[model samples]
Target: MSWRRALKDTARSGIAVEKKRLEPLIAVRGAAGLAIVIALSLWLFGPAAAASSAFGAFQAAIATFQRSWRPRPELAIASGTSLAVSTFLGYLTISKEPLFLALLVVWAFAAGMSWAAGPTIGLIASSNVAIMLVTVTLPTSVAQAAGHAAMMIVGGLVQAALIVLFPVRRWGAHRDALADALAAEADYARRLRHDPVASFDPQPLMEARNAAAVTPRQARRRPAELHGARGIAERIRPVLASLADPAMGVPAEGPARDRVRELLASAAALLDAAAHAIRHGEPVSTPPAALATFRTPDTGSILTGAPYRAMTRLNTLLQDVVETAGGAPQESALQGGAPKGRGELRDQPQPTRTRPRTAPHHPPRRRPTFLALIPKALKAMRSELHRGSPITRHATRVSAVAATGYILGTWLPLGHGYWAPLTSVMVMRPDFSQTYSRAVARLAGTVIGVAVATGVVQAATPGTLQSGTLAVASAALMYLLMRTGQFATQACIAAYVVFLLGMGGEEWTQTVPERVLLTLMGGFLAMLAYAVYPAWETPRLRTRLADWLAAQGPYAAAVFGSYADPSASNAPDVRGALLTARTARAAWHAAVARATAEPVRHRGLSRTAADDAEDALAQLGRVAMLLEAHLPERGATPVPPAARFADALRESTHKGAKAIRERRVPTWDAVREALDAWETEDTDKVLRNTATLVLDTLTELSEALDTAVPPMTLDGTAPEKPDGPRNPKDSATR
Candidate 1:
C-alpha cells in the first residue's frame, strides 16, 4: 500500500479530529483552558525570576494544551471535571484554615491516586501540585496563593459550562460528515452496478460504506455511540454487552458482520433498482427489473419445476431489504418461519443455519437458494481486506517508530532536549507531508508564546486586572487559531505562551530570540528525519488497483461465457460470477482514496483504465440479471451465445484501454479485432454484452484521443452513450 498517501489521508483526518471533533470535545471536558490557568497562576505567584517563571508558565501552558486535546467524550469530560474540582480543593487548602487543611490533603490524595482513572483526575492532581509548588517556592504570601487559586477556579468553571453548550453542535458536525459519507457510498454503489471492473480504487467506497453503516441515527444505535458526551454514559455497558466474544471486544463469529454487510448490499441494490425504475418512469412499488436474475443460477438443475418457483419466491422475499430497511418486515417474517434444527431456539433463527430441520411428517424444509447473496458476502470480504490491509501495517510501523524514538530520547542522555521526545510524536506521522506543516507551526507558535509570556510577566504582572484580561483574550485567541494554518497558529500560540511566561518586563530582548531559534531547530530536525525514509503512495495504489482488476477480468470473462451458449449444459454458474463481480466492486471502492491522492497524471491514467474494465463488469452484471429473470420465465434451455459475444468485445476493449493508458496509438489490427468479435457472436446476449464492450471501448478510444490531441489535460467525462447500429470491424489476427 502507498504509505505516504495513506499517511497524508490519515493526517488530514487527524486535523479534522483535532478541529471539529477533538477541540470541541476538549471544551466539553473543560481541560482545554488548563493551559491558560496554569500560565496565569505561575505569573501571579511564582518567583519574580525573569526566565524561569516565564519559561515555566510557557512550558506548563504547552503541556496543558497538548494534554487537553483528548478525543473520546468521556475522557475529555472526566479530565475537565477533575481539573475544576481539584482547583477548588487547592484553593481551599491555600486559604490555610485549620478545618480546610484535612479536606485539602484528602483532595490532593484523591487527585493523584485517581489520575490513572481519567484525564480529570490527572489534571486535578497536576493543578494542585502546581499551586502548591508555586505558593511555597515563590516569595509570595499566603494571600497570593489564594489569589492564584481563585483564578484557576474561574477558568475551570468556564470550561465546564462550555461542555453543555457545544454537545449538539458537535453532534451536528458528526451527522454531516456521516451524511456525506453515505451519499458518496450510494454514488459508488450505483457506479459499481453499472460497471464493476472499470475502476480499481475502492477506498472511498469502502470508507463511505462503513461510514454510512455506522452513521449516528436515533433509530439505529451502535455500542460505540454511547461513548459520546451527548449520550448516556451508562448505555455504553449495555451496547458493549450486546457485542459477542466478550474477551475480544468484537462480535462473536456469527451473522453480525454478515447481517450488516447483507443489509448494506441489499440497500445498495434496492437503491440502484429504485434509481433505474424512477429514471425509466417505472412504478416504484413494482418488482425491480434488475432482481429477476438473482433467483436461479444459469448452470444449475435447481431452476427446473417446483425448485424454480421456490427460487422466485425467495427473490421476492429478499427484495424488501433493498426497497427500504423499514419495509423488511416481510423478509423478517420469512426468516422467522425458517426451520432451525436441534440446539437452536425457535424464534429469530440465526442466518447461518446450514440445513433445515426435519418436521418428520412433512417434506424436508429446503431454504431458498438465493444466488444474489453471494455478491454481498464477496463484496464484504473484499472491502474488509482492502480498507483494513494497507493501513494496518502502516499504522503499526509508525507506532513502532514513534515508541522506539520516545524510549531512546527518554533513557539516553539528552540534556535540556527533553522536548525531542514530544516533537517525535508530533512530527513523525505516517503522513509525512502534513508533519512538516505542523512542525513549522509548532516552532512559530512556541517562539511567539514565549515572547508573549515574557511581556505579560514583565509588564502587567500576574493576578492583576490587566494581566487577567490578557490571559482570557489569549485563551480565546488560542481556541480560535487551533487548526488554522501553522504559521497563524504559531503567532497565536506564541503570544499565549509568552503572556503566560513572566517576561513582561524589559528583559524580553534576551530570551525571545533564543526560544524561537531552539523551536525552529526542533521542527527542522523532525522534517529532515521524515524526508530520509519518505514513502510515496502511488506505487501501492497502482499495485492494489492492478490486483483488483486482474481478479475481475476472469470473473468478467466467466460471466460473458455464461451469456454465450445459454443452452450449453455445462455453462459457468451465475452465483460465482455475481460473487466475483461484487468482490470486484468492493475492491474498486477501497482503492478510490489512494487513487485520488495520486498526482493528476497518474490518477487520470488509473481511473481511465479502471473505467474501461468496469464496462465489461457492468455488462456481466446486466447479463446475470437477465439470466436470473429468463430462467423462471422459460425452461432451462440454452439462453444463446451472449457470453462469447460480450467476451469478444470486452477483450478488445480491455486491450484498447491498456493501450490508451500506455500512451500507445491503436493499430488497425486492434481496431479490426474490436469490431469483428461482436459480429461473430449474434444473439440478444451477444448484442447486450457486445454493446457494453463497445461503450467501454469507445471510452478507451477517447482516453487515447487525449494523447493524440495536443495541450493535454485530464478529461474525466461520463462514458458517452453509443449510437447507431453495431458496425462490425474487419476481423484481425490476435
Candidate 2:
C-alpha cells in the first residue's frame, strides 16, 4: 500500500476497533440488566431451597440502579450500566464455591428487595441478612448446588425479559387529558368576557380546572418547574454576557432580564393564590390589579411573594427549555393568522338571531330569591368538585382499589403462587395499563440472568464462610440498586444469584414454564382491576375553569378601581387579586388534565377556548398595569350614562350566571356590532358605551343559549381600537 493510503486505512481500522471495543461494554450493561430480572423473579417465585439466594442478587441490582438514577451529577444511564456490570462480575466470582453460591443467592434476594424499596429497604434487608447468616440451612453437595443454580438461572432469564419490556401507555392519554381540560377552561373564560369588573370567585371550580390540566401533564412529563431549574444557569449566562458587552457599556440589559425575572417571580405568588383559592373555595383575585407595578419597577430589586418566586423559578426553567429547543426564533407574528399589527383584536363572529328586538329589557327575569340561586350555586359547586381537581376523589378511590388488590393477592389462597405475589405489585402501579410490553421485559431479563448464573455455579468451591461473605456484598449491592431507580436491573441481579445457588444436582428446569405463567397471570389481574372503576375526567377540568372564570370579573374591577385612586394602597388589594389569578390559573391547568385524559373526547373539544380565557385574564392584567401607569393622569374617568353602564353590568352578570351553569356561548352579531363601537370609545365614554352594549348583548346571549347555538368563528371584522371615539351603533340609539 502507498504510505498515504496505508495511514488512511490504518485510521479507519483504528476507528472500527474502538467501535468494536465499546460493544462489549454495552453488552455487559444489558447482561447486568438481565441479572436484575433474574434476581427479582428468584426471590419472588423461587422454590424454598433457592429463594434466599435469588433474593440477594435481586436486592443488589436494585440498590445499584437506585444509586445510578438518583438526582445527582452522574449520568443516570451510565451509572446504572456500571453498577449492573459490577454485580454480574461479583456473581461470577462467587460462583466457584458451593458456600459462596448459596450465600450469594440469599444476599442477592435481600439486596434486590432493598433496592426496590430504597434506603428503608436497605436497613430491612441488612437486618434480614444478618439473621439468615446467623442461621445457615442444609449443607449442599457441589453437584446438588450446581443443579439448583442452573434452574435459578433459567428463572432469572425469564423474569428479565418481562422487566425490559414495560411500556408507557399513560403518556398519550395524559396529552389528551390536557387538551380536554383546556377546552373546559376556555368555556369558563368565555363567560367572563362581558363582566369587565365583577369579581368572579374561583372557589372549588378553579382547583378542578388546574387538576384537569396539570394532572395528565404531570403523569406524562416531569414538571417544568421541577426539572426545568437546571437550565437556569445556561439561560442567564448569555443574558449576563450581553450586559457585559463593551459597546453596551453599563449593564442596562439587567433591567430587562430582571423585569422578566420579576414577572416569573410573581408567578410563584400567583400559584400561592391558586392554592389559597382551592383551599378557601372562592374566586381568586384578578391578575391585572395584582401585577401592574412589577411590570415597571422603580428599583430593579427582587420582589418577594409566592407568585413572584414561582415565576422566577419558572422563567429560568422556560428559558432553559426555550434554549434547548433552539432558543425562541426571531419573534414571528403570533400563530394562526393573528393580525400582524399590535393593536388589532380579532372580532369574534356575531350570531344571526331572529329573536325580536322588542324582547323585554329585563333578563328572562331570574326569580330574584336567594333560594332560587342556591340550587344553581350548589350545582356549580358539585361540578367544581368533580371536574376541577386532578387529584380527585376518584383518583383516591383508585389508589384504594389498588391497595386492596395487593392485600387480596397477598392474603388469598392463590397468594402462594409466584404469579400472585408479582401481580400484587405490578397491577397496582398506575402505569400498568400497557401490559403487553411489561410482560416482554419480564421474560427477557429472566432468561439472560438465569443463563449467566447457571454458568457461574458450574465452577466453584464449597464452604459456608465464603457463601456468607458473598451474601453481605449482595445485600450492599441491592441497597445501591434500589437507590438508582431501575427495577429491571434489581430484578435481574436477584434472579441470577438465586439460580446459581440452586445449581445443585436436583432437577429444577421443569418449574420454569410454571413461573412464567404465574407472572403473566399476576400482571393481567392488575390491569383488569385498574379499568373497572373508570373515573370520569371531564368534570374536574370544567369545574376548575368555572371557578377561576368566576373570579376574573371582581378581580379586574378591584384592580381597576384601586388604580383609579393613587392615595389608596392598591398593593394589598392587588396582591390579593394576584393570589386569586394564581389560583384560577392553577385550576385551569387541572381542568386541562381532566379533559384530555381521553384522546377522542379531548380532540372533540379544542383547547382554543381555554387559551382565550387565559389570554383574556392576561390581557386584563396588562390593562391593570396600563391603568396603574396612567391612572393618576386620567383621574377616575366620568361614569358613563347609567343606562349604558347598567346594561353592560347586567350582561356581565348574565355571562357569569351562564358560566356557573357550564353553558357554551351563543352566537350574536348585532350585539357584536354594538360592542365593537363601545370598545373604541374613550375612558370617559367607556362606562356608558359598555353598559349599553352589554345590555343588548346579554339579552341576545340569553336568547341564543335557550336555542343552544354553538359559536364557531370570530366575526372577522377589525377590532375597535381603544384610543379614539368610534361611532355608536345605529341600533343602540333605539
Candidate 3:
C-alpha cells in the first residue's frame, strides 16, 4: 500500500456512515440527566458553570454506551469520578502555563496507556483530558474549583440514580451474547447437513465467555435464565460437528447418514427456539415433531458405535438447554419421553431434570469483575512500559502531539487555545489506520459544524436558555447516532461544544474561525506525529503467529491427553487452554486487520501466504474441537499410544513456533511417526480415523506458512495459490 492509496482509503473509511440501532429511551434518560444538571447550575452559579457541569452528564452517557460487559451504572460513576479528578487537578495549575502544560502531557500519556485495559477505558480517559481544559477556566478560587468538581460527580450520580430507578433490559448485553452463541450453533447445525466438514467460527462463544464474568454483588442479582446456559452451548458445538462428520462417526451415505441429517435439522430447530427463549426471557416453545424424533428409539437403533454415543449425548445436552432457558425446570419446553439407559441420569423420566442431571462436568469459568480488574489492568499496563510495545509508542506519540498542539494554539492568535489540544487528543489512536482515519473525520466534521453553529448564533443571538436547549438537543442527537460511525457522532459533538460555548457568552465571529482553524491544526499535528514514528503491525505478524501456534499446541494436547487416560482428564486445564487459544487467535486476526491497511510490507510473508496460514490454523482448531466433543467417559479404559501421539504433537508444535520466529520452515516428522505408531498399535477405530486427519492438518499448516512460493498459482494470480482451507477438509474425507 502506498501513502497516496492509504490516504484515500482512510478518507473513504472516515467519511463512511454506518447503520446503528437507536435507543430513544436511553437517549432521553441521558438528556434528562443533562437538563437537570444544567438547570440547577444556571440558577445557582451562572451559565458558564452550567456549561462546564453539563460534560459530567454528557460523558457519563457516552461511557454507558461503550461495548463493555460492566454494568451501566458502574460505567457512569467511574466516568464522572475520573472527569472530576481531571478537573480538580487542572484547576490547581490553571494560572501557571508551564505547570498546566506538564499536567496536560502527563494526563494525555496516561489516557493513551489506558488502551491496554480496553478501548472503553482509553476513550473515557482521553475525553477527560479534553473536558479538563474546558472546566479549568471556569473556577477562580481553590474553593470554587472543589465545588465545581463536586458538581461533576453529582451529575454522574444523577445519571446512575436514574438508571437504577428505571431499568431497561437490565441483562440485555449478556442475554444477547448467550443467544448469539446458541444461534450460531443452530446455524452451524443447519449448514452441516449439506457440508458436514464445514468450519464453525468460535467468536460468538468467546464473546459469551467475556459477558459471563461478574462481581459478587452482580452474581447475586443476576437473572436465573443466564446461569449455566453458556456451558451447555459450549458443549453442543463439538457434539454437532462430531455427529455430522463422516470420518468421525457415520458413513458418508447410508440410512445412518439420513438419520443424522434429520437429527441435525431437529437440533437446529430446537436450538433456535431455545435461543429465542433465552434472548426474550420467555418460555421455550419447542416443536413436537422435533421432540418426537429424539424420543423415537428408531434413530438410536440406526446409529451405532460412535454415532450412537453422539446421539445420546446430544439428546441429553438438548434437555439441559430446555431446563436452563428462562429458568424453566423441564416443563414441556424440552421434557417428554423417558431418557435412554444413559446411566448418568438418575431417573428415566423426571420433569425436574436440569443440567446437573446430564450435562458434562466442565470446570467452572469465572470472568473478573470491574473491581477485580484493577490489578490485572495495572499488570497489563506495566507490561507495555517497554519502549518497543505499541501502547508505549502510542502514549509517547500522543503526549508529544498534545504538548505541541497546546503551544501552537497559545502562540497563534486564536483566543480558545484548548480547542487545538482537544482535537488532537480526540483524533489520535494507537494505530496508523485509526489515527489517520479519525484525524480526517474530526477535521471534516469540525468545518461543517463551525459553519452551521456560526450561522445559527449570528441569526438568533440566543440567550442562555436557548443555547442550553440547543446543546441538549445536540447531545440527544449524538447519543441517538452514536453507532452511525464516528463521523456522524463527531458532527453532533462539535455543534454541541459550540452551543455550550455560546452559553458562556462567546460571539460567533470569535468562535467560528478559531474552532475551525484550531481543529485543523490539531488534526494535522496528530497525523504528522503518527507518520514520523509509527508502530506498524506488519513487523509483529510473525510474533502474533508464533503466539497463536504456542497456545494452539497445548489446547490440542489437553484434549488428546484426555483420551489417553479418561479418568485423568482435567476439565479446568482444557477450558483454560481453549480460552488462551481463542485469545491468541483473536490477537492474530486483529493484527492482520491492522497490517493490511498499513503501507509497510510484510518482511517475509506475503498477503496471500498470510491468508493461507490463517486458514490452516483455523482448520487445526476445528479438528481439535471435534475431538473434544467425543471425549471418553471417566473410568473408561485408556489408550496408551494416544498419549504418545499427543506428546509428539505438543513437542513438534513447540519447535515449529520457535522455527517460525526464526523465519524457518517447520517440520512435523515426529508427529507423522507417532501417527504411524498409533495406526499400527491401536485397534480403536475412532483414534485411527482422527489420527490421520490431525497429522494432515498439522502438515498443511507447516506447508502454508513456508515463505518460498511458486511464481504463479493455479489461477495465475501472482504467487498466490488456489488451494485454501479445503486441503485439510478434503483430507478429512478420506
Winner by lDDT: 3
Model 2 lDDT, full chain set: 0.35
lDDT of 3 by residue, 644-690 (tens): 98899899889888867766666678888887788777468777667
Model 1 Cα shift for residue 532 (angstroms)? 2.1
Clashing pairs in 3: none
Q: Write the per-residue lDDT of candidate 2 for residues 1-734, one digit (tens) a residue.
A: 23344334323332221111122222334335444544443354343333433433333333323211121111222223322332343334433445433443444333323322333333333323322321123124444334334433443343334333532222222222322322332232233222212233333333222232332214244322222212232222222222221111222234533443344344333333333332333333424422442334332233222212222333333223222222223112111111111112123221121111122111221222323433653454345344333223333333343334334434555422333334333323222222223333444444544444334444543233333334334434433333232234334443434443443222224334444455555445544544454344443444454455455444444544453454555545654665575577665765565344332233223455445444444443333322222222233333333323324333464365444345454222333444565566655442333334333433432333333323432344332212221211222333
Residue 206, model 1: Cα distance from true site in angstroms: 4.9
TM-score of each: 0.41, 0.36, 0.93
In model 2, the Cα lDDT at residue 636 comes to: 32
lDDT scores in order:
0.38, 0.35, 0.82
Model 1 accuracy (lDDT, Cα): 0.38
Global local distance difference test of model 3: 0.82
Error of 3 at 359 (Å): 13
Clashes of 3: 0
Ordered by lDDT, highest first, the candidates read: 3, 1, 2
